[model samples]
Target chain A: MDQITLYTWIGFSVFLVLMLVVGYLSSKKMKSIRDFATGGGTLGPYVLGFSFAATYLSAATFLGYPGWSYEWGLSNLWLFLAIIAGGPIGVLMVAKKVRKLNNGQKSLSLPDWLGDFYKSDILRVGTGLILLFNIFYIAAQFVAGAKIFEYLLGMSYTSGLLLIALIVVIYVYAGGALADIYTDAVQAFIMAIAGIGIFISGIVIFWKGGISDTFAGISHELAAQNENLVAVFNPESLHFYSIGAVIGAIVIQWAFASAPHLFNKVLGLKNEQDLGKMIATYVVVAALSVLVLFGGLYSRAALGDTASAADLALMDYIIWAFPAIVVALFGVVILAAAMSTTDGIFVSISTVFANDIFLKFLVKRNIVKVSDEKAEKIAFQISRLTVPFIGLLALLIVIRPPEYMGDVMWIGISGIAAGTMGPILQAVYAKRKAPARAAELSMFVGLGSYLFLYFTGIIPSTMSAGAVSVFIGIATINIASWILRSASSSEMGAAEEGGS
Target chain B: INEMLSIWLYGFIIALIIIGFSLWKWYF
Candidate 1:
């Protein structure tokens, strides 16, 4: 109806049409599952590098990061640092090991790797549950993107969600990994450009009137000024962890990077040698993370008290605080970042559910050592169908979202960090296998504790209470394992001496 | 040649050991 609305819809529609064409072309070449999920393991260093980066980032980075930085001041940068740590470390530490294990296999998903690791159908099934949790998180991202479009363009949220969803799914389904990779490369470029442009505009706003005067303008009308309206940090404030924030940041980032969906990107790398480049790329991207942090802080300084809701603050700045063209560019960048990430998570969740849970239990119970071609193709087909189903389910839940996109996501992360990270991390690091019973018990305890804490609101939402619970669960499993191992070893030693 | 190298290695080790003992006491 309105000029701005008309332009916004037109821009979004044109973008969607181009994406659909690309997706259609991508699907034509999708002969197998590897081609669907991992870009056929043939993605070059550059595409692979950016695709991986884009997959980890989302609207959360674009919209959520600045909102968070705006609210918490410079202290919020610590969380960004924690996130940056997770990406590079996961790539460096896990890449070689994952490649060696998945060796020459065209596996499409994380569950495929986990299924191989435990050599147990049951473990794969449990991993599927974890993947489902990941799906909830991904679905939220999709909903967030739609919400952004609806608010900015004055379209109905439902319509915007469906419009974006249709375009993303069509492209991803048809093009499979090819379309996802190519588009992600393009999106990454757009994201960088948008970040630089918006950030510069935010700076210019501050230059027009520095923080001292901006506060003076707002200080008259507003009583009890929001303490976080500035870029400065204060030690006495509870805005940062004090001591807990530092420890919490370290623990959470370690778990986030090690998340199966994020780490599975390693399996998609072109070669073992390419890992060096991947790690190098991660370092650069990690530094770029500071850009989002500064952007949010700068925007906060520009808007002052007028920036009420943190989530929409960045978007509001782009729309009202800048020119029409910058606003359009911002929308494009957010859509690009959000779509690539949402698709990756969607594909991952479906693949894990299909291959790890359904295929292992229902379809092929006795198949022990399936190769990449068989596994990847079968898993990918399952994911293609299931992703839309999962997307629809997410759509239903997001109708009245819990709060902002970042809030719901953090809670979901807490639930996952509590449930899966403990046992998985223990399994990886201990050089000793958890007893079957112990692993099962620890998972139950960790998952149950996290849910209890989240639902009851016993744990402050500030710290990663879920990751902490995971650590407790892991400790329980290791202690049990230690006791059992010691008793068995001593008994064997005594028996050998008697026999001699 | 292997034996000669081994003897040289022993001498270098003795001189290094003298330096290490001297440095350790001085630093402490």
Candidate 2:
């Protein structure tokens, strides 16, 4: 519509071409399936660290977080703190053990890791089902990215979704983990720059209104919500449910990076020491990202009170206060966030289906037993092709994108959080090892509960279903483990006495 | 008295150096 808009498209087109070229070049060297899936475990810290961070922070953070904060006022700061709490704890606790276990096992996906840990095909298949849930999750990311493009660039949402899906498929399928890591490094840098720019611009607006006046405005606006926005904690309020929602957010954010795609990055680290470094670096960087969450609150306070505030909060301010160039640049930043997340999800889903599901179920089914080398190679090849197929699947699913793309993305995140986090935490850290049977039971219970809540409409609309499901799932696992362990201990004592 | 004290201090210093070096190499 205008010169700046034309220039923005031009820059995006150039960026797209550059990514394609990189993808093509990276595809040229495909000596083994290992190379495709794990970058032959040669990726340096720069790629490993940033790729991990960027993949976790999707368009949901870039667009949806700010919008939600805008609607809720500064009180949503609790959610930001929740993210900070969960990220470091996860790194210090879970990551090292995962790295040690991954040694010598060529795990192309998270389910592959589960298979290695449990030494059971059934467990691996169950993990694959969990990954399949990510297909809808990844679809949500693509839809959100496209909806943003449609809203800002005047393109049809379908066209935008298709374009993003195609790019992700080609780049990931062609270059595998190599392209994803490199592009991730670039995307991470772009996000950091974009985040800083938005913060500074938003700060300038507040500065113009003067600090005191800004607070006065925010307080007045928050008054409509009963002036409880700045009051940090109110135990007996509807906001109480929302505040409690922070715990679920914390668990999900911490575990999201440890999902199949990103967790595989742990194995790709050069050594045990590097794994430690990755954890520390990732935790620190991730902690800093909480600032963006605060920036969202600041923007909300600056914007006037309105009911439809969530969707319009961030963009509304940018569109009005900034020049066309700055607005366009911010759009690109959101685009990068969406693409980084969707691409990782696409790669992860493909890896799970190809490596764990198809290779185990279809390709290697006839063999009574398979060699490690053959298993690794087949899993790698299947994983390599999975990227594009997943992209195609996402393209189809996202054809009719949801109107509330942000909520859709969170729903997907909740599915992973509830289904996987409960089982993973138990298997990794609980003093008693959950039997494979118990873990499997937890997965089903968690997934079933989430679906039930969604369909039955029993839970409050604003609360995350994953929060309730994970709590229930963990309870189920602990109870089952206690009963099974007690029975096994008694049987073992009887057997020992009989043998003596 | 001086020799024993110095020996104890030297061992502590060397231990600290080794631990510091190991951590630096591991993290950075």
- Quick one: best TM-score, which candidate? 2
Give stretches of model 1 more than 4 Å off. Answer: A1-3, A29-42, A97-108, A162-179, A208-224, A228-241, A260-273, A366-385, A490-500, B1-28
Native contacts, share recovered per candidate: 0.00, 0.05
DockQ by candidate, in order = 0.01, 0.04
Fill in the DockQ of model 1: 0.01
Model 2 error, position A353 (Å)? 2.4
**Model 2 stretches with alpha carbons more than 4 Å out:** A29-47, A170-178, A208-243, A257-261, A267-277, A294-299, A302-309, A367-403, A461-463, A489-500, B1-28
Which CAPRI tier for candidate 2? incorrect
Q: For model 1, which pairs clash?
A: A26-A175, A27-A174, A27-A175, A36-A177, A241-A245
Go through the candidates in order and give each one's C-alpha lDDT.
0.59, 0.62
TM-score of every prediction relative to native: 0.78, 0.79
Q: How many residue pairs collide in each prediction?
A: 5, 0
lDDT of 2 by residue, A32-103 (tens): 543554463677765677666666566666666666566555545555555545554555556666665555
**Model 1 chain A weakest 10-residue run by lDDT:** A215-224
